[model samples]
Target: MEVYSYRSDQLAASPKEVFQIVNDDEQLKKIFTILKDIEYSTKGKRSKGAKFRITLGVRNKTYRFRNEITEYVENEKIVMKTKLKQGVITTLFSVEPKGAGSELSVQSSIESSMGVRMFIMTVKPVVKSVMNKEMKKFEAAVISEN
Candidate 1:
């Protein structure tokens, strides 16, 4: 398993506000440039075990995947899991109050075959750059909400 993590700078928002933005589909699409679209399968309120389909446009190719919320902690954290042909991917999004603001973090674990692992190794730097930018954008969006 290969893991990549990212943390955002403290934003001028509370933990509850950050959590809400991360879980909101429209907010996600607006902040994450690569996120093309999200289709929720779980009706009504979202909670543990909720499922959604995400289509991401990356490097000119569109990849679609189904993700399930495996863990949920209101105003604190959310963990999502996705199964691919090669392996499974798990992502955790967490927030904590820092000073008068909040900090957001993301940890993603990829368990895949050797070929995919090699590809990930090659593109890890680029991914990190993109994730950093996304986090910055997220912070900005959260600040704008205040």
Candidate 2:
């Protein structure tokens, strides 16, 4: 398994505000350009055990994945687990109060087969670059909403 993580700079928002924005599917699609679609596969309050089908467009190809909310803590954290053909990708989004604002942290772990692991290692730099760009967009969105 391989892991990647990043913590955003402080933004002019509260932890609850950050959590609300992150959980809003419509806002997320607008903030993250690579995301094509996100539809909830399970119906209920926004909490742990909920599922979603996500579609992402990357380099002209569309990739779809099943994502489940493994853990959720209002105003604090959310953990999503996505299953890939060759592996599982777990992502955690956490927010904490910082002075008058809040900071958001994101972490992603990839557990894959040997072949997929080798492939990931080769493109790790590219993956990191894309992730950084996405994070920047997220930060901008949060700040703009403040």
Candidate 3:
């Protein structure tokens, strides 16, 4: 498995507020610019073991995947491990309040099958760039929400 991440140095909202926004699929969908749609397969608020399917539009192509929240910590962190057509991707988000702003970070662990390992190398950069862009969009949306 290969892990990749991005952290932001700006203050948007409080960690608690950010957590609320991220925990709800509807709020999260509004913040994701590239998201086509996201549906929670399970009922109730987002908690550990919640499952969701997400479709993201990127580079003129749409990629769909299903994920489950394996870990959830209020105002602090979330870890979602998704099953893709080619591999298992684990994504983590962490938030910390700083002096005048909060620090937000996202990490992804890509566990590829032997057959898809070679393809991962070629797509890693693209994935990183896309993740960066998406996080930025999410940040801006949350900030504007307050």
Candidate 4:
């Protein structure tokens, strides 16, 4: 299993506000250009066990992953797991109240299939960079909304 984590801080926003921004599908479309499409499969709103089909570009290669929300603690954390063609990926979003704002952290891990471990090793750096860039974009979007 290979792990990569990125942390970004945005000021003057409550945990609820941050969670709303991140959980909103329409808002997400505006924040990340790499995401081509997202279809959520839960009733009225977001909740644990809600499934989504996420189409994103990774390393210039478009991939679609089906992610299921494994855990959702309002204003605190969200955990999602996906099984990609190359591996299994888990993403955790954590929000902590800081002063009058909040600090958000994303921790993700990717475990490649035995046969494709070499490919994952070779592309680890690029993957990490992409993840960092995405997180920065998310932070900027959240901060601007405040």
Candidate 5:
């Protein structure tokens, strides 16, 4: 498994508010420019078992993947899973209150079959770097909204 983690802080928002923004499709689209579209399978907003199709831009290439929300804890955590061409990907978002704002942490893991391990290893650093940059953008977006 290849693991990558990123963390960011946004001012003047609670953990709940941060979580709401992260889970909101409209808000996320505004924050993540790489997301061209998000299609939700289950209605009524984000929750465990809900599936979403996300179009993302990676290294000048656009990739689409179907992801399922596997775990959720209101105001605290969310976990999602997806199968990509390279492997099984799992992402966890954790939020915690910080003084008058919030701290958000994202942890992503990519597990590949033996045959594809080398591919995953080769891309892990690039993926981590991109995720860190995106997380900073997310923090700025949240702060601006507040």
Candidate 6:
């Protein structure tokens, strides 16, 4: 298993506010730069059993992955899992109220076969670096909105 994690510096919004913005597809699209495209299989609100396909462009290569919401807790936690050619990716998002603002953190876990271990390990730092930048971008967007 390979893990990558990041915590936001601090946002001028509540935990619920941050969670809502991150969960909103439109808001996320405005904040995240690496997402090339996203399509939802359903037209319902954000909840468990929702299915979506995300197209990510990284290092000049495009990868499409299907994501299903495995677990969700409003203003608290979200867990999503995806099975890709390289591995099984599981991502967790947690939000907590802090000082007059809020803090949001994301943890990603990748599980792959034996041979891909080295490749995955080498890519971990890159993933963390991107997440760190994205986290800052997200926080800034959320803070500026208020």
lDDT of each: 0.82, 0.83, 0.81, 0.80, 0.80, 0.81
Candidate 1 C-alpha RMSD relative to the actual structure: 1.9
* Residues 32-85, model 1: lDDT tens digits: 999999888888335798898899877788889989999889999988898776
Which pairs of residues collide in model 6? none
RMSD of each: 1.9, 1.7, 2.0, 2.2, 2.0, 1.7
**Candidate 5 TM-score, C-alpha based:** 0.87
User: Which residue pairs in candidate 1 have backbone atoms (N, alpha carbon, C) closer than 3 angstroms, thus clashing?
Assistant: none
1 or 4, greater by lDDT = 1
Which should have the higher TM-score, number 1 or number 6? 6
**Candidate 3 lDDT tens digits, 1-146:** 66577888776688887787786767777677678888778984468998888898888999889999998888999888989777788888899998766899888877667767887777879988887778878888778878
**Which 10-residue window of candidate 4 scores lowest in summed lDDT?**
2-11
Which scores higher on lDDT, 1 or 2? Answer: 2
Q: In model 5, where do residues sit more than 4 Å from their true spots? A: 9-12
Model 6 global lDDT (CA atoms, 0 to 1): 0.81
Candidate 2: give its CA RMSD in angstroms.
1.7
Which candidate's lDDT is highest?
2
Q: Cα miss at 130, model 5 (Å)?
A: 1.8
Off by over 4 Å in 1: none
Per-residue lDDT of candidate 6, residues 24-138 (tens digit): 8778877888787889897744688878899987878888999988888888888888877777789998888889987778888887667568767888888888878878898
Model 4 lDDT tens row, 19-68: 88977888887788778899777763467888888898766789888998
Query: What is the lDDT, from 0 to 100, of the residue 28 in candidate 6?
Result: 87
Candidate scoring better on lDDT of 3 and 5: 3
- Give the alpha carbon lDDT tens digit for every residue of 60-87 in model 2: 8888999999899999998989997767
Candidate 1 lowest-lDDT run of ten: 1-10
Question: What's the distance in Å from true for residue 18, model 6?
Answer: 0.5
On TM-score, the leading prediction is 2
**Candidate 4 vs. true structure, TM-score:** 0.85
TM-score of 3: 0.85
Superposed on all Cα atoms, model 4 deviates from the true structure by an RMSD in Å of 2.2
Residue 145 lDDT in candidate 6:
75
